[model samples]
Each structure stands twice: as structure tokens, then as C-alpha cells.
Target: MPPSLLLQHAPCARPTAKRTASLFSAAVLASKDGGGARPPRPRPRGKPRFSRQSAIRKSFQQEQVVFSTPVSPDPTVAVIGGGASGLACASALAARGVRSVVFDTGMHGLGGRMATRAVDDERQLVFDHAAQFFTASDERFQKLVEEWVERGLVREWRGSIGELEAGGHFRPIHSSTPRYIGVNGMRPLADAMLPENDLIKVIRPSWISKLEPFNGLWRLFENEKPRGQYDAIVIAHNGKCANRLLSTSGLPQLTKQMKRLELSSVWALLAAFEGPFPIPHNNSYGTFEGAFVRGVDSLSWMANNTRKLFPFETDRPECWTFFSTASYGRRNKVPQENIPNATAEKVQREMLGGVELALGLSKGSLQLPFYTRVQLWGAALPMNTPGVPCIFDPQGRAGICGDWLTGSSIEAAVLSGISLGDHVADYFASCGERPEEFAIGLDDSLNRVEGHDIGQFPGLDSSQKPQVAEAQLTATI
Candidate 1:
């Protein structure tokens, strides 16, 4: 009989050499015992006639077994600023398969100090008012900048800047390498680093009021409401905001150290004119020691932004940015509305005088259409003092990384992010779990009592009680 017929007749059957031999012996023994022909040992109870068919079916079933691949978990990080520092942090985390959320109070845009303005008219124009130019000082940043240049997002500005002395003398300072600017505007650099989806969620018009440790997670509050939680937080803003956040959290060591940081302010004046002012190419930094104002230039830093400038708007004429002196920045304590008229008049007079000296142009010889606006940067740059640690890892888990932590430059910000990121990655490797990395100190202990002001922000309602089930059990025992 065929194996298929035999299997159909008896679902449970075995085909083995020992069993076949035993069945043959049993048949012979039965034949001798019985009077007539042996019963053939009852057909060996249900052995298949063809054994190969059973092996093929077993092999087929084995081949059909399914296997699953495991997926890695995504890490959560919170970036406090949307400026260059924060953007670089988010980008680095995203590249490592981590998700980051960037929060910025700056007007719905990415750039913090690297700001630009949009001019409205029959033909629109975008001009960069802040961060007049940037240079790459590190290999990592330099390589990234080269890539940006190749993509046409940035281009080199080639010219000699004439430095103005405090005594009204102007001298030219030569820069070997060209200064680079964004092709369209400075904000594109920040925009390019953000992820498309929730991997990087940018929250604009939302300011983080306070941060506290809640149930082993860092909870961030915005406007007294729980915004979100993060495994790690990167404060990329200026020293003032950083100091405020650290102090409000009640971290004594960080608070005490952050008090020493001092940030300088910058007041910027933006203007647009139809005709080009007579000045040397890349004319910048004219000094006036005795006068109220210091530096003056017609085209302080100008490019035929319409054509030569890669990232600038092509529909507009040459774009220029005039920088205010540090003295002017300190004196201008009033609002922005009152700054433009005085700044423009003073700068125009200085530029006209310089033009007459350079190109023999009288005051009325230049006919130009101009627009002026001023910006006051409360914390433009951070003072990098010696003996200051770039990162403060007092609690090991709690760390500070930003431009203020290192040198006050874009490169320093990037380096700070990279350094902190490595520290965080190494920290996870050392600890089996998150809590193991941070020892709960007596000073860091919570009140754990009900209706207490535990970890609540100032002026916020403290109705919610602390979840102390673990503490309650310890007290009961």
C-alpha cells in the first residue's frame, strides 16, 4: 500500500527498522503458535509502507517556521532653544535614532541671534540683520560648512574690511579666507537640521517656565501646564535664561555657579538704500574714540544680494547690515521704536564723510532709498572666563551644555553639544538602568508630604499631592 493511503487509514503511525524487525519476529512467532497462516502481526499496528513521504512533510513544516526581527527603542531628548546650538543637538540625536523636541520662544522662527528681516513691497526682499558673518574654526564644523556651501546654502564674501579707530582714522584689515553667508537667509541653517516628523517637534511661542524631577522623569512645564517629559534636557539658550531655569529648579551648586556669568547686549540697526553708498568693498569697522558713535560705513557689509549672494532674495538690490558699537548698545536702554531715526542720521553723516574722502562725493551727490530698524539683544554673547568648567556634571545625570559653557561662538556650541551627547551615551552604558546613574542625595530629597510646595513652579496652583507610595511603605515598616 502507498504511504499516503496508509497515513489516511491510520493518522498515528511510526516507521522504524527496530519496529519492523520486531513485527517480523512477532509474525513468525504467531504463525508457529497459530494453527493456520500467521495474522502478519496485525500489520504492525499502523506502520507506514513508504517512510520517505513522512520525512518530506516534516521537512516542509520546519521550513514554514516564521522568525521576527527586534526593533530598537527611541530615546527622548528635550532641546531648550531653536538656535544653532539646539538645532545641532537635535540633528545629532536624530541621526542616532533618537527623538528630540525643540522649544523656542523666538517668534515662530528657528534662528535666535542669526536673524533676518522680510521687506514688503511690489518686490519683496529678505535681509540678514544679525550674525553678519560666520567662520568655521573646527574640522567638524568646517566639513559641515563645506557641504552647506556645495548645496548652495552658503557662499563666501570676499573683501577687505576697513577698521575705524576711536580717533576717526580708518585702516584696512585683510582677511585671507572669505566670510560665508547663507544663500537665502541665516535661518536656513537651523531649518535644515530639523527632522520632518515627530522625531523633532518644534514648539514656537511656547516658553518653558520650569523643570522638575517627577517620578524618575524630568517634567517640563509651559505656562503652568505640563508640556512634556524628557530623558535628557539640553539648555541651549543664553546665560540669562539658563541661569533662571537652573536657579528656579533649586539646584544649589548650579545656581551659585551660574550667578557669575555675565552676558553683553547688542543693538542692531538695519537699513536699505536704492543707490550704493561710496565705500571700499566690505567696508566695516570705522572707529570714533571721542564721538558718541564709533564704527560707520555706507555698505557696512554689502552684497549684490539679488545676484551675487546665493541665499539672498534675487528681486532686491544690494543688501547691507550695520553693526552698532558696544557703547551705543549699552546706552540705548529705551525701546526699539526710538532707535532708528537717530542711528540712521548719525550713520548717514559718517558714511557721507567717508564717501567724500574715498570718492569725492558731496552730501547730496548720493540719491538712495533707505529703510532702518534696530534690535536690542539683551544677552548677545557670553563671557568665557578662565577656570570655568564647560560642563557641570555634579549629579552626573544633570549636566549643562551651551555656548556659555564653552567659548562664545557657534563652534563652541556645536562642540558642547557633541561633548554632552557623548557623556550621556557613556552614562547609559555604565548604568544598567536610568536611576542607577543618579544617587538620591539627602540634599536632593523631596518633602514627600501632602499639600506641600514640592517641585511646583512659583505662582502655580499646588493642589496636586506628591505620589509617595514607596515612601509611605518605608514609613509604615
Candidate 2:
């Protein structure tokens, strides 16, 4: 994520309409209409050149990223982290006759940070606590999304978005590209990708603490105990987790590089109001799906989860997730689950204060949510990344893949997984040890993806424009 994720001003475009949305989840993606390509290079007189931090507002800034591995053979593989990257890797490998077992902490269920909170009470209400929607422009990902659309697993979110400025002014945001969300909730999208008794196996509520070697294969340990053995392991997770796991797995060089990829924290609060959604400061749109707020320290994002769902309803109780800025989260981070700097009620009031200010409501106008839950992500917004697509060690027969490989965003996550899986499959095929029914193929689009150990590769020709666009959307809250 960009260091200026929380610092986009009028001079810089935001992610939503180039309205920055790093606070929404661990990774952020910009819409086609949100932040477009740099307008024909040469600036308009006095306008400053958009900084890399500002470049992040653009969703696709394709880097010359490549995933290469010097590996031997693999049949049973272990994929850690059940997020977008991990699941996609497993799915690709499974289709190729490679068997993999996925392990995750599952704090947010099978989707990792892509989660939804199903509020329990007399009335059923759900809040998309993370990753409101994702954009698919790549051919392969577009094909994958098409299948999901056909199965009624996802739907387009066509509602108009707005940006909230420092003065509380709100304006309409128009975009050409469509934003898609899960049919029921984001979690269902991940749940639907699970294969039945084949190459993919899911182990949830599991924290993989370490990895060890026995004989020729790898032994995975959960909570400090040996869990299973596998021919290879994929570290599909954040940089911190990857570094720790690699450090213990006897890969010091890789661990040191991973440790350099830093990330910031965020606090996501899920709440459901009793009345209709809150009106904007100027009541501009009559209703809106979401807003990217600037000049507010307490809150950076606010979304009406119900409104984002297709067939927008005029009358529906508002349910939204508020994401706190890195500064705010760091200030209020609890030492323990029970021990806290402030009482629960006090924290709730402070969060509500940001909402009320954004909506131009008077004191206490925002009602207390009937259902409320707070979650702290120590590694929410990615700060710096390796941007190498994926990493592998043939001698160790292990590798790592995630959004961190190419900064943080949904697109990065998907591409990273696909690239890693391809290398793994190719490694097996080269060793003449892969299954005969292998279906994995590296065609034209993949050749466009090139990666290295250090320094950004310059392939800024017209052909690589889409990839550059894809890499441009990595900002934080």
C-alpha cells in the first residue's frame, strides 16, 4: 500500500473515484472510473506530476513481474492462508491434478480478510466487513469471474459512489468499469471455490506455526505440533507470517527479503443501524452505496453493505463497516482481548463520532448499532512489497505467494497465486514427475509476467500498459 494512502488530497485522485480505499481491507483495488491512467503524460501547465503514492490510486500499473522456481517434484502440497491468493493457487493446482491441503486461522472464516459479519438477532442482517467489491479486467480473471456470474455466485454493483472532501462536501463519482461483489456475501465467493475430494483440501481454525523437514518431504506443524507431511509447501500469507515461517524453515535469505516488506494495521468495526441509511452531508444522491472520506482521522471508509447488493432498496436498515486509519488504530490497539485502553462503550462512541461528522448529523444522531463487533488487523494495509510475483526454492521444494508479492490488492492476489501455481506445475513437468493429467498451461498472458530478485524491471511499453494499471492501485487507509 502507498505511504500516502491516508494522504490523498484534491491534488491527488482517490481510489473510489480515485477515492483511496486501502482502509477497506488488507489490499485495495481502484475502479476503471475511479482512477484512470495518467492523462497523456505531459502535465497541464502548473499541475504536478502524480507521485507513486498517487500512482497507487490507479488500479492497474503492471510491473514486469515473474515467478520462477528451481524445484524438483510435488504431489501433495500444503497451501497456507485461505485468502484470495491462497484459494486461487489451490484451485489452479487442483485443476492440474496436483493435490493440496489448505490451512488457515479462519478468524474471518474461509475467506481470510475477505469476510462478512452475519449479525444474529430477531432480524437477519449482514455486513461486508472487508473487500466490498473487486474489478476483473484481465482475460483469465475475467473468464473466472464469468463462470462465477453464470452460477449466480456474484453480481455487479452499479450504484453511483461519492467522495467526501475535507469540508464535508460530497459529489457524484462516475466510472465506466463495473464493480462486482459476492451474491450473498464475500465469504460465499471463497466458499464456492472449494473442490470436492480432489486436489484441494481445506483445514480451518488452524494456525500453522512452523514447518520442518523429515527425510525428503516437508512436515507442517500447527500450534507447535506436527500436523502432516507434504512434498511441497506454499506460504500463501502476509509478509510477517511468511518471514517467520521461512526463518524457521531454514530459508534465511528469503526471510530477510520478506521482512523488508512492511505493512500497517487497521481497525474494522461492523455495525448495523435501526433506521434507513444515513443521508449524505448535502443529501446529494438521495442514497449511495459507499463513500471515501478524506480529512477525517477517526474514519477513512464507510459503506452501506445492503445498498451495494444489486436491486437497491429504498427502505432498508443500514448496515456498514467503518475502517479506522492506521494512526487511529495504532492509538487504540488493545494490549489483549480483555485488557483495553478504553471501555467498549467509549470506543463505540468515538467511532460513531466519525460517522456523525461525515453525515453532518448532530451529536448522538447516529444510533447505537444493535449488532456491533470490532476487529484489529495488525497487518491490514501493506506498506512495501517484494513485487516479484512469487518466490521459490527448488532445493527446499517450497515457495511463497500472496498479494504482498506485488504490493496489496485483489488483482495482485489473483495474479500472484496464478503465477506461483504455474511455476510449481512447470517445475514438476520439467522434472518429469507431474501427473499425466496435468491441465495447467502457460500461454500468452503469463509470458507478459516477469519477476526478479531486486529492483523494478522497466518494460513500460504500450503492451504492458494493462499490467501497470493493475499495479497502480495499492494505497492504505
Candidate 3:
């Protein structure tokens, strides 16, 4: 079947193969008994067994060579931000026989928003503080996710999640769409996706403060110290850091495009309580692990971290993470690196009050948490997007890829990174000449999906909505 025409079939077809084998063995045994038994039932038809042939796989299969030889030999790339997009870009480039170095500011590990906090207290508390979970809608990303599942690095998060209305009404989100998370935590998944080869080098706990173009190469610097130069550079992060780095990078067009992205600040509150919330729910959908709070100013989301990790383990202390609304975050914004004690206490009080309202509990009904923490995401997520897969500057040999470029999701960041890697590989295959299709995302005529928030937004009634039409994202790179 044509790649695009292939339909997604149910995963239950594997049992049919086992059934057919049993029937064939039974027929042999009956034949040995003087053919007294009836012939075996005919093999079933019309269903394809589980297959690994995704659209992305088929596209590569059609090509003469999966990894074409690059015209420029041994070209090195510098990828800033070791998040999903940055790691994915490095992986893609490595597959094409190119080398890359990834730079990140993560003190503990990589996986920017796919973060986790492990408390050293005796309670053995762990929390997926940032992105709760991710869904794969694109074929390319689906293929990668499937591979990760087989390798035991990722698993489906089947926990019950839905909307928590203002008056404490719990409505489960009714969708079969699979939600995925790392086996240990979101950060490990990002760590696993890093290419296991010498071609990809990672420098963690390092920040690239500036980029200087000198003699046809981009030189990266960390404050006063110089981090080696590279033939090409890919900016795989957004927000203030990216803007400041690009402002003096000598790439006016790319800088202009980067400045167009607007990000929203968000506050995340993590607390460990002695027991679960006393909210009532139907037993059919399972215990609520997460919820998107609606009509609540101080809170926008809440999830049970302990339940998400061990859904059946009821004896453990319940750890819940809450997120403040964009507007609330803006109003109560504080310095991220060093938040004041008074501000933290106020935010905790107000957000917990909001949580009480979401659960319809009386004031001060909930018990004090055993452990509590507050973090402010200055550039939590993008408010809007450019609706492009990625942005690249051929003349400056620079590119930008992130969830902010396409949509607010881990899948978007992966897709954008892979696309830019392929685009650059194609450019090098042509011997330093820009290909006819310089960048597919730069084409304005193509019908592309607009950027949509994967999580709760400022004004959306529904927890999440489908990606808007092409008209919604009219901004061009």
C-alpha cells in the first residue's frame, strides 16, 4: 500500500497469528488419527498483522541509499540546548554520518521541560515537575516512540485524566489516544534518545552565552571562554536565553524570526500529602491521576505523581503537582534563580487555595503537606507559534528548532529537530550549494497545521484542543 494511504489498524491482530498456528497443529494431529476430524478452519483475512513499516520507514526504503554520503566530509555542528529538539537533531545528524556537539544548561541532566525532581528525604519522593506526558500524532514521531517502547525506555501512561470544573465536577477525558512517559522519568527518555556514537558529543552543565561569526564559521562562547567553532549551528531552545544569544549573532533575519515567538510564564507547585484527595468519582474510569482545572485563576492543572508512577500502590504518600494559570503566573512572577521567601509562601497559599476551590473543599480543609516546593517557569510554553517545521538561515548556516516553532508538545520538538537535520544533510549532499527545496517549512504555499497548546491555556474551556486551521498561524519565518 502507498505510504500515505496506509491505515492504522488495531493492535489486536497478533492473537490471530497464534490462533492460526494452533489450528494448523490441530489439523496435523487429526490427520494422524485416520483423518476423522474436520479440516482446520481457513486462515482469517483482511487484517494486516502488526507491522513496523511506518510512513517514515517507507520514505527511507524508497530511497536508493538511506544515508547518502555528504559532499563536505567531516563537517561538525554545534547544537545549543540539550533538550528534546537538540538531542533529536544531533541524533538525526549522526545517522547521516555528521558529527555534532550538544550544549545544555541543565545542572542535573538534560530534558528541559521533561524534568523530574527527586527529593532526598526519607519519603523517597519523586515528581515529574514539568511536562506531565506526551502524545505522538505524527507518523515519524510515532515510529520513534514505538522503538522507545520496545527498548523499555518509554511506556504508556494509562492513568485516568480529565477536567476538574470550577464546582468540583470531575469529567474524565474520553479518548483512546495513547499518552507516553519515560519508565523512570521524562529525563531518562531524553538521555536514552541521545545517539550512542562518537559522532555525537554532549557537554552538560554548560551554557553557550554568545555566538560569533568569524571567517565563514560560527564560534560559540561561554561568557569570556570560547567554546570551539563549528561549520553550522542549530538553536534548539527558545525564550530569553535564545533571544539574547541571537541578538548579537550577526544574523538579522534569523534574529527577527526568533523575536516573534512569545512565551508564557508558569508556576508549578509540588506538595506531598499524607493521603489522596477526598474527591468522589466513578469507579469505572479508575482513580484520577491528573486533571486540568477550569475557571480557577491560581491553578490550572493538578496531578498525582506517586499515583502516576505506581497507580496501584495506595500505601505510599500521595504527591500532587499543581500548575498556576498563565495569567496567575504573570501576576505572581518572581526571579526564577532566587525567589524570595515571602513570594514563595504567598504563591503557595494562593495556589493551594485555588486547589481547594477546584476540589470544592472548605477553607483550610486539606492538611498541611509534608514537603512543598515552588518553581517558576519564566518561558514555560509559547503563547503562539510560527506554524513552520523549523527556521534556517543558509547564508549564516544557522537554524532554530523547538516546540515553540511548531506547537507546544514534545512531539513537535522532535519533529522539528529531525526535519532541520534532514534539511541540513540535504544541503551538504549538494556540495555547499542550497538545494532546490532550501527549507520545506519556509514554503508559504504548503497547507500546514497551525500551532496549538498541548496543555491548558489561558482562555480555552477544553483542557486541550485540536491544532487550528492553517489560517490560525499566518506568521512566516
lDDT of 3: 0.68
For model 3, residues 220-325, the per-residue Cα lDDT tens digits are 7898566765668899988888989887666655666777766667888899999777774423444688887777888777889898887777788998888887
The per-residue C-alpha lDDT of model 3 at residue 364 equals 93
Candidate 1 residue-wise lDDT, 1-477, digit = tens: 001111111111122323323432333211122221222122223522322211112221121111111111223567788777677666655444345677888784886765667777655555665654566666666777787787788777554333343323455434455556677777677676554434456788678888664323356788667676555566767556677787655344445545655544454445566654444333344321111112332222222333334333443554544444333444553444355666646654544443344333454665554665545565654432322223433232355556555444455555566555445444433332443443222122112222110111112122233222211100000
**Which candidate would rank higher by TM-score, 2 or 3?**
3
lDDT of 2 by residue, 140-237 (tens): 66777777898898888777665665445676556566677788888887777665434466788788887765444466777756566565778788
Lowest-sum lDDT 10-residue window in model 1: 1-10
User: Candidate 2: deviation at residue 28, Å?
Assistant: 39
Arranged by TM-score, best first? 3, 2, 1
TM-score, candidate 1, is: 0.62
Model 2, TM vs. native: 0.73
Q: Between candidates 1 and 2, which one is better according to lDDT?
A: 2
lDDT of each: 0.46, 0.58, 0.68
Tell me how many residue pairs clash in candidate 2: 27
Q: Which candidate should be chosen as best, given lDDT against the real structure?
A: 3
Instruction: Tell me the spans in candidate 2 whose CA falls farther than 4 Å from its real position.
Output: 1-74, 278-283, 310-316, 335-346, 432-477
TM-score of each: 0.62, 0.73, 0.78
In model 1, the clashing pairs are 164-285, 164-286, 164-287, 165-287, 166-289, 183-310, 183-311, 183-312, 184-311
Clashing pairs in 3: none
